[model samples]
Target: MRKNKLSFQERAGSLQEECLCFCEEASREAMFQAPIELPEGFVIDPAEAVTNVTWNADSLSCVSERCFIETGPEPDEIAVQFAVRLQGTVTLLVSVSPVRNQYGQGNGAVSVIHSAEIDQVVYYSDEPDDCPDFSDIRIENLVVVPPFYGSPLSVTGTIVLVPEPDQRSYVFTANSGDSTVSVIDTEVNTLVSNISLSDIPTDLGVTLDKAYTYVLHGNANLVSIINNETLTVTQTTPLAGAPRKIQFETGGEFAYILAGGSSIYEINISSQTITNTFTVSPAADDFALDPNGQFFYTTNSGIWVVNKYDIKTGQLIDRLSNLETPNVIETPLIGDFAYLENGELRPNVVSVIDLTTFSKSSQINRLFDGLITIVFSDDGTRAFFLEPFPENLTVVDTAQHTMITTASLPGASDIAVTPDNQYIYAAQPDDNTVTVYRTSDYTAVSVIPVGTGPAAIAM
Candidate 1:
């Protein structure tokens, strides 16, 4: 009784594998979350050079789902390549290269305007007369019907291109109140770009190949680095301190900057500079990074210590003390354990810390007062945060440390979750909106508005 869909005629030239790949529900990891045009001039080349596998799918043209794209049209260009089809794992990719035209002898028909719950796939190039008659193919879902779509390319002439597909996921929002970062587009939730940041951004990261997005700025301590294909900010770099947390380094070379709370630099993601430096004798406003990459949790509010550094020689490996004013430090996308949070405006307490055994096992208390960010649940079992004088949103079950529900997000200032935990976005800076909850029943499924003071979010 499980059938959402699945089809793939798989044929080409001479009608041999001309192309058809339909997937559905959860079969073969069916995918294609939105944005699917591409037939007109076509322009999507996420650097277009795939080798092993790791594709950023989007709709019929961009070739959705687990990936594996192959193209070969060279009278002018037709190079779409990507390959990450896993199960037994077969890697072979090469997309984006065809742009030549005028090969239309009789008729053509290449359609997939979407919404049939898609996972669309396409392929062509077995000498169908060489294929390539898109003098103005145009697309936005794609439907270029010419005169040949009857199980044939019309006297053997087939040239139907598809290229518009760039919107699988995105949600950057770092509105340091107004310095701007915005971005959203998690498949049509909208607010596509907004970028302008000169100061105050404070935390946002992504780059395991999401193509770059590292912003941290508080009083201009700077770091700005964006380039998600060209949303531009290219690089800013400067940071002697003042910024506050920005992690990455699950082997992608390196990155970890938790500024002037007593320094901790170390970046170098392909030369975005700052190779190494780590100090914290009496500084630590926030910092956490040990998703198994090897420790560096810092959080101090009035001497309640919690430092642990040494994510590769930054030294000073331990100090865990009794917590009470812990500031903020989070780490749990996979866990070795660490949460911290502490208190300041009144009642607060998260403190989990258990990097294997560096101690302080559990806490989780919160009458409110502070907890703007802290997400986890890529199977870590749940743990979300955000509760500032009743802006409420807490959900946490991290293996039984309780508090399984709460929802009201009045002015919520930051939160992000969606690696499949279903959804939960909240960033309402006084109604500039961002909402979008539904981790099963937390409700409110859409809001979007974004800009003015969005605070922080990432994914």
Candidate 2:
């Protein structure tokens, strides 16, 4: 076979043609599928002062960076500051200085700058301190030593405090059909303040550094951005096709709003405005993010492979669109797999996705009715869900990839695992109850009644 070489002019012309073709196709597809009413926000360039990296050698507090920079205390590790130039308003960052490694020394040392507390909640109850405290002497069979429990307190129903630890905590309750977020003091388990937003909170995304909280109001086509410190609404951004879920960038520069249709809205956290928009249609109601802030997964239209996207730019990097219909996408956990709540309405299943090759590693399904949410244990070894109609919790073992046990809940609409992994809280909107359970024995620790109709619970 003879090879034909083309001239430089022809090559350049071909490349330009291809690029134009792609642009036209993308534009045509967007026009055909997007809603006629345009998204209600203007795009503005971010200021240089807010996007540049400013570092203080003596204080070690890196500021003015488009994103937050971090370091640890290691004799050999030199502290360096680096930030990314974002496209919208000011960058909102909240970092905990002490918990992070001063010079990156300890084995488990972690120094976080933005939204770190949200990640810390996963480490909250990781210890085995939940065992019954037995310090008094017992006589033969019965020892009435001030009783085993401290006091019932008969909570006005139970409200769960998810401590971001060493930082701030969040309160999750079902007093309303949707969820309400509140700031809590982790040490005392007391409610410090409630995040005041004009719209009803349906879903939530809190920054890692604990600086801001993103609340999605599905019915209002709006998202309320609240400052963690002030505990008040900072900005209300708009969304396309009515928002269903929300996720934040790794740097807390912008937030991505996922809707029921084919478009994703990018909101500038600093300016509290919408800057850019992308298309990832038919995305499922939920999504997940990787720790490195590199990739995120969600379903579009149907569950085949979860759609993996680039966090820096609103671009579709890849799609694990290998699932059959009725697959519900979940965020990726520590392990390389993204947990999937699968099966249609009748026989719901949870499948594990291996990120390495974008394949299903394991899948388990059952004829359990009303499987609503999937709450994973701290170790990711077990998953919990709520069944519909006669609401209850179903515990599935990830290792065996099977439903190990089912505990009858008071009528759970949503559930959350305490950061410490010691307890699981279930929200019952119909009966106004929040059920708390011990993960070890899968037993009910407390049944605290809460708001009227709790829909979602987060730790």
Candidate 3:
């Protein structure tokens, strides 16, 4: 038999054609029968086989199931490539094949054989002149093996390409007993530092720009402004009376400080001076601002009343009465609805009020009596509530207006939800720890230890 030698161009073209065909078939299979969808703004690139490696049958025995193939200039292994353009959060679903010989163990086996095996998966951004280093690329999974011939093993994972607007980098918790503010790095879930205050810290408010954290000093008649970058108290503004709660404007230009009596002072951030004062009911305990910063909902602890006032003019817009101890007020990400934790004495419930009509739309009842704090999911479809006295956490579906489920926590004093809506953090003051539960399964994932009396939490 005579052997025919092929030219370099012919071999290259043949290999390219084979790669394209393989990719097309793989994509079709993935699209029709894939367990998960491919992330938006991303698509699988063609499978480019190594040209240096021979596909002859004699090489099949010597080939290892686990082999590394360098795709870029650096010597690194890559099973497949996905091209992405937009910058946002995305999850990748990848399918990999196991190493197997093309020819079966038979006497009349074919002369030419091919092998397919994928052991690991890695990813990196393909943009910018100075591409990300190898260290920046993350390996999502390894040691993946296909279950059957011509079928690829599938794996799913999530990643954040660009930082989310509400994805907090740090969380601030007020330890009243120790008179300190514990700063937690949300990325590592660790206590990075603690800022000691002169008096007991009652509440905390972080500016929109995250430049400073306003600490309300209990009975100190002052607000300690701690610079976030410096992690120290930069300035202290004296108030007329002791401040209980603090909320910031959208731009962080001014802060609304709820002091003793009926005073709500608007303090200028730059000058650290009280610019204006507005009066609500004599004993309004807590307040929540609408998303547009147009209206402020104030809850009166002593009476069953919630007062709505214009933020700019300080005029009474509407008053919702006939409630039981409406102490906490919260608006969802969308400003159309406001949830008020009311009926503290009997029939503990959350009043859902329409922001447009300023009327009670409905109420979520069957809650235990105790101090309550509420936080909404990022999408505003669900709400998580923390209640004391045989402490428990309840999740409510906003659209359905019903309680989805409840989990018992011995000392759940405070609760905060992540911006991504993946996890909820509940402060167990008596236990001196914070329990993190997964939003999808409602399973406790981690317990983070904090300072004594973790009274307040802000993310």
Whichever of 1 and 2 has more TM-score, that candidate is 2
- Which candidate number would show the highest TM-score if scored against the true structure? 3
Q: How much lDDT does each candidate structure score?
A: 0.62, 0.50, 0.62
- lDDT by residue (323-429, candidate 1, tens digit) is 77788777765757777777655777776777889787877755556776777766778888776756477788877656777778677777778878888787876
Candidate 3, residues 1-459: lDDT per residue as tens digits? 011223546545655665421111111001112232223333222142111112111211111121122221222212222222222112233343221233322122111122332212122222223222222223222232223564433332222222223434777888887888887777878777767677888888777677788888867888888777546676777887889877776556888888885788898887877788988864688887776778788888686788889988889988888777777788775548878877756646777888888888898755656546777776788888777755377788888668888877667767778879888777766776777778788788788888788888777
Clash counts for the predictions, in order: 27, 43, 0
Per-model TM against the reference = 0.28, 0.55, 0.60
Q: For all the candidates, what are their Cα RMSDs to the real structure?
A: 21.1, 26.5, 19.8
Candidate 2 Cα errors over 4 Å, as ranges: 1-168, 174-196, 248-254, 267-275, 282-286, 290-292, 300-306, 317-322, 365-370, 377-382, 389-391, 397-404, 447-450
Better of 1 and 2 by lDDT: 1
Model 2 per-residue lDDT tens digits across residues 127-174: 223211112111121111111254311101111112122445655442
Candidate 1 off by > 4 Å? 1-184, 190-208, 211-247, 250-287, 290-295, 298-303, 313-315, 318-327, 330-340, 348-368, 372-385, 388-408, 411-457
- Kindly provide the TM-score of model 2 when superposed on the true structure, using C-alpha atoms: 0.55
Cα misplacement distance, residue 103 of candidate 2 (Å): 34
Model 1 TM-score? 0.28
